[model samples]
Target: MTTDEDELYDADEDPYALALRSGRGPVYLRLVDGRRIRMPVHRWHEQPTVADKTVLERCIGPVLDVGCGPGRMCRALLSRGVFALGVDIAPRAVALTTAQGGLALRRSVFDRLPAERGWKTVLLIDGNIGIGGDPQGLLRRCGGLIAPTGCLVVEVELHDVEERYNARFENLQGQSGPFFPWARLGRRALNSIAADLALSVTDQWSSGDRCFATLAHQGSSFDCPDAGRR
Candidate 1:
């Protein structure tokens, strides 16, 4: 299977590889617009926090964790007897997840994934909604990947901006990798993106600094968490 289509880092010396090998320090996303987003590489090895547990508790059925770096969420779900699988484009990420006793595959979300249209929950957390730099396209794919009654559980930015961006991997030392495509969607922007794909925000909630929303196809009403203002 192909690695993540948006992966632009060199295998020999990518930020992910360095982080995985050293097991510490910084990895950053350098946006083409001269912005940098920090990625917490160490958190993948840490236990699930309240935000993670909240998301896990909200999951309905068989779960697919996309862009599952190091598989912390997947491992947590499995501990609760929930069938969860993690997929990532980084081989090191896959290895780390598996090494930690979590089930994971080194594959892209755009590729042929297992259990098509059978998953009950598809997770796009940790800014993973930004993958491929096309929120609508990715959401469309996730819509097709889930069962008719399934829902998408997503974590979005806290702001109100929605835009596609060119990004790349970088480290604290100022070294950078090739530019790739990415996107970001906040709750308001997410609403617009979801509506375009005919998805309805069933529920929304927040925990600490993170925000999450659950979605299902329009007109298919399902009891979600406390409804947040649309």
Candidate 2:
């Protein structure tokens, strides 16, 4: 559930906050093409922005928020009486979620999750698909987390390029995490990514600078996309 970073930061301290004071914690996605995109990490800690609310409005059923930091989206869903659960590896994030009257668990997406293949919607907002540095693997895992007809709403890069990179989480203090595989996919790349895993993109939308796509199994029936195989 909790990670080493939980021990590194105090109960009241958060990486985003620290980054704000020091001006450097924003996670950067360094592509192989010599292009690096700086993520708006601080936005995750603030109240749900208009763009985030627009994305939340698309949910139609029980939702699972992957890499839910501080649980802003979870809180918003709860206010709508929606059944939502936020999971993150950071203890403080889970605590913050529950503190705000939202359901949260300290866990990793790669680990066992509740109600596998049963959720109506699984969200990969805020560029969370980059978690664990394997976008394809994460998308495949999300394919199993949602119901056969369920939709996977993912927020992707707003560019027109697709790239994979080694990512690291760094703070204003210049502290950085270990290098991990990560990826950036724009609207043009969604179909290719989904088709690779036998999934398909059903819809694409944008709010402000944020872009999202809805994914589903290519077949009409419901079955774990990665079931019976690694």
Candidate 3:
């Protein structure tokens, strides 16, 4: 008889989880319109890239990496002697992170997390700003996760597009997982949402095909060693 843990593992046999365990993927996010957006799984499994460095440089110590997939960012930060913690809803993700010597927790951004409002840098990289398909709600939650002088670093779409819909994880072979709520926000859309949350966009820049923005509380200030060097 299969145990409940065995059943749980069996039920997680989706493309995303498989890719994480194997460290490879041609995984795609199948949108409701039938359009597929390719997910950069290989990059997530590898060491930090030049583009990733751009994000890493802006981060202050005691960082929180929301949706940290394979834990590359967390690992990188720890190697740099920066205290970082990665959180994800996937067990495999947290396992891989700790296995690689990075601190991680299997938890959702909306769930109760440690160090509430005390993290110096909160990251929503790899399109995680779209976590719940409710960008405004997500941003509000992130605002509460950072210190008053801390900042939130987010990666936005390269193009000008804002959308919310259900999406599935699909492999190249056409196998797919259950549909879940997802969203996409360009820089402009992110800025608008940040404004409503009383968060100010402190910086914005592009590295290769990815675009990023930094948001902070209206009157608070924090030290980013690489600020303005981009």
The prediction achieving the highest lDDT against the true structure is 3
Q: Model-by-model lDDT, in order?
A: 0.81, 0.74, 0.86
lDDT of 2 by residue, 1-230 (tens): 87544454563543332322223345654444555567676787678898887667777558999988778898888888888998887766776677678898988899999999989889998878777667888999999988887888889888886766775555444654555677667877777889998887876777788888878888845321321121
lDDT of 1: 0.81
For 163-186, candidate 3 gives per-residue lDDT tens digits of: 999998887666778888999999
Q: Which 10 consecutive positions of candidate 1 have the poorest summed lDDT?
A: 221-230
Candidate 2 vs candidate 3: the TM-score winner is 3
Instruction: Name the TM-score of candidate 2.
Output: 0.80
Work out the TM-score per prediction.
0.88, 0.80, 0.92
- Which pairs clash (backbone N, Cα, C closer than 3 Å) in model 1? 133-182
lDDT of 2 at 64: 96
* Best-to-worst ranking by lDDT: 3, 1, 2
